[model samples]
Target: MTITQKIKSLPLTFLLLFFTAVNIFGQKPNIVLIISDDHACQAISAYGSRLTQTPNIDRLAKEGAIFNNAYVTNSLCGPSRASILTGTYSNINGFKDNISYNFDFNQPSFVKALQAAGYQTAWIGKMHLGDSIPQGLDYYNILPGQGQYYNPDFIRSGNVQKRYTGYVTNIIEALSNEWLDHRDRQKPFCLIIGHKATHRVWMPDLEDLGSFDDKTFDLPHDFYDDYATRKAAAVQDMTIAKTMRMGHDLKMYDPADSATFEDNIKRMNADQKAKWFAYYAKIKKDLDAKRPEGRALTEWKYQRYLKDYLATAASMDRNIGKTLDYLDKNGLSKNTIVIYMSDQGFYMGEHGWFDKRFMYEESFRTPMVMRYPGVIKPGTAINDFIMNIDLAPTLIEAGKGQAPAPVQGRSFLPLLKNQHYTARDAMYYHYYENGEHSVSPHFGIRTKRYKLIRFYKRVESWELFDLQKDPHELHNIYDEPGSKPVIADLKAKLLKLITAYKDTEAAAIFARAI
Candidate 1:
């Protein structure tokens, strides 16, 4: 081969290389899934939230599809995540609650399927599905359990624990950017970024301290809701009035006491600690001066909780913007699909509750916004009944991978594309936690117009709500006069859903009830 001959062949060689690269990476869209912990739809401005502005999250809604009817199979963190990964309910996934169960890595997962199908995958940040390394990932760096806010420790690949000195949300953003910068560009990739902001003990970033303090939050219309006929609601322990602690939750603590608060903040560096403590010190001083009692104190706590929660969420939203910016700057936005959602919806004083685990709307419905440039039209509002369990199949389908047979969730990719879509008549929900929050184990079904909840075990009672009339679920019309036909139809639908989903335990319970 002479020099002239080699030069002539160069064009063909370059063309072959370009075609190879296209074949490897251009066949499917890359996915970026951002899952924040316990982020309520009410906190996002795009979701009509008056409490706070999540401009970054709103950007996703503005540029893509915002799902109004997104829900979860289970409301708890671990169980919800398990459902998301496996596209199956807690009953089938075997992670019923965060307390008693560890996620079985051996189970069939969409991540495993995607990886097997030649896509690079990684999960970074809060994966609260136990300490075991998550399955089917090229890389993983997860927070242990609920994870800390300040100077948090992350469990990386090889089960190595490393402490990163900064706000958890910011650190996650930095790590995600780093991964995006160095990931193999020849292959399609899926990256799931989990955030620990806005969870319990809402700790804001140094700059975000007291971000929402200037604004006074109006309590929900049912902030002082009386239990009335809702037997399950009457017995739960998750309330801002009682369950939230002053020192731990609201940052109202005397320096001399409150070891739990100390332990929480011990990881902060000297400057971080000083800035944090000094900010809270003023709040404590004002609290001591006022000495608010009874309703005043409860309202005081609610105000603080909202301020801290929104402030913490501000950081998460900022990080989300950073991620979106990265994608746009790198020209990846055209082919990349960005999804932002909470593991499950949270309570902003709805029913005077603080935590999730009930079949109530606040905890059951998650905030989901997705951006797929060519596929999903900008500002498209999706009102179909989509659950967290559908995430695995949807992403799998988007990435050109197949979900396993055991997966129960159907892909909502059609919904995004405005294709022929058949909406489910009802969605099933089950919460298996009998412990924390004292919420009884229960299961129910939610349709477009109605929600039928059966509080089993400790509180064996039925509560039905006409969501069209009482959007807040204030009235339990299960045994009301002239409600027998609706109750019977809902009961039959609930039983059918339980049977269809293969929840043997729920089926047995339903049989006994019938």
Candidate 2:
């Protein structure tokens, strides 16, 4: 008999060979994950942006399956990215906020998992998981907590935090390209290209400042959401009127580079004042000359929003196009899976919000695109209820390997193959309150056409929406008698999901609601 047949008869040898085969096949995908920080899916032309032209990001969606219903388990930054990495929820991973906190590398993250499976793993750009990074990672180039637009400090290896002289955009790409060049060509790799663009205090590169100076954009219909619908929305720290800084945002300054000012600039000397005024003189003049009114003010915000935001996307997309070109040039596109996604979706003046913390559709629905030549059909749309946690399992499945245990997600490989596959009946969402900002702690469930949300530890509030009737989620119908049966059914399912996912708070709330 052949050694393979003899080994199949022998129990230990068969188990060993089976395990070896699983490891070999499971870690074979050359994954290229491109992630942007706080990037609004609405801002990208690929997702439906009329003003912003993001051809590269659009091309990613054009060449791959665009998932219309992908979401993050947690809404915040570190928490969401951690979930993606470990395929575990925030509570399980123990890293919830963006502040200083360590991601326990004990959990099998995709980086570590790929490393274990003999694949080269490298992470570049923003890895805000924690201070103490792990060993055995092939190469790491991470930005400190929230990196800057110009002249950013990056940690090459852990102890070496060096300030680079160039823009962060170019520097990160330089490192990524270098890593790609040095890596073994025969070995598969997993490269995570994370970006620090379009986050808070949106700053653009110098080259992109005058790109959209002449254009104006429109605002959403509900730019003014009356807080009467939800109590927590009433007491939030995020408002464009009060929250936006005037001096930083407006860019107002004196007219000329003179040695003195007209009793105005108090915080500087003659030379310094002259420099400041010279820097912002033109911008201030432009603003003073233009008087925007009514929808114009909203339009101004949209214009400012896009000009500043799309610059980041423009630079980022250019880098992405460069990588795509490299893949094509190197004949790697056929055997590679390329995915571009944000940590979570962001709001582009949707319902008068700037950031994404609400259970609203804008924040809940993320932009997801998958391009795998062997599996996914180009330009396909899958409405499957998938989460960030599912990414690891799906990649593992595509590699023809089993996912590790204790993950609260299912692979969407079947959906990629056949978009009509039915795997999940409902998707659950839970946002915890850490008080960095006053986002109400809430948990909910979203099915194909229905959504139910329950506010926690406060006023015992509930919201129900028939998405078919109201796609915008403008009205809250929690008290409607018509939805009692549906609410009950969903609540039961939510409770079961809580138990399965080990969401202690949701399980408690579910018990109380029952």
lDDT scores in order: 0.90, 0.74
lDDT of 2 by residue, 1-514 (tens): 9987976787897789787657644546688998888887787887777768888888888898788788988787888888888788877777766664678877777666667667787888987788776553788888878776666788876567887655677778888888888988777888888888767656565566657777766667777877666666677656554444445443443444232232223424456445445545666566679966555555565556656677767788788888888888876776688998988888777666677877788888787787887577788877768899998877766655456786677788777777555678888778775465567778888888888888766446788888999888877777777878988888888887777788886777766742
> Judged by TM-score, which candidate is best?
1
* Highest lDDT against the true fold, candidate: 1
lDDT of 2: 0.74
- Model 1 per-residue lDDT tens digits across residues 129-231: 9866688999988889999998889988898889998889999999999988889998889999999887998999889997787999899999999989998
TM-score list, all predictions:
0.94, 0.86
What 10-residue stretch in candidate 1 is worst by lDDT? 254-263
Which residue pairs in candidate 1 have backbone atoms (N, alpha carbon, C) closer than 3 angstroms, thus clashing? none
Candidate 1 residue spans exceeding 4 A from truth: 1-26, 260-262
Clash count, predicted structure 2: 0
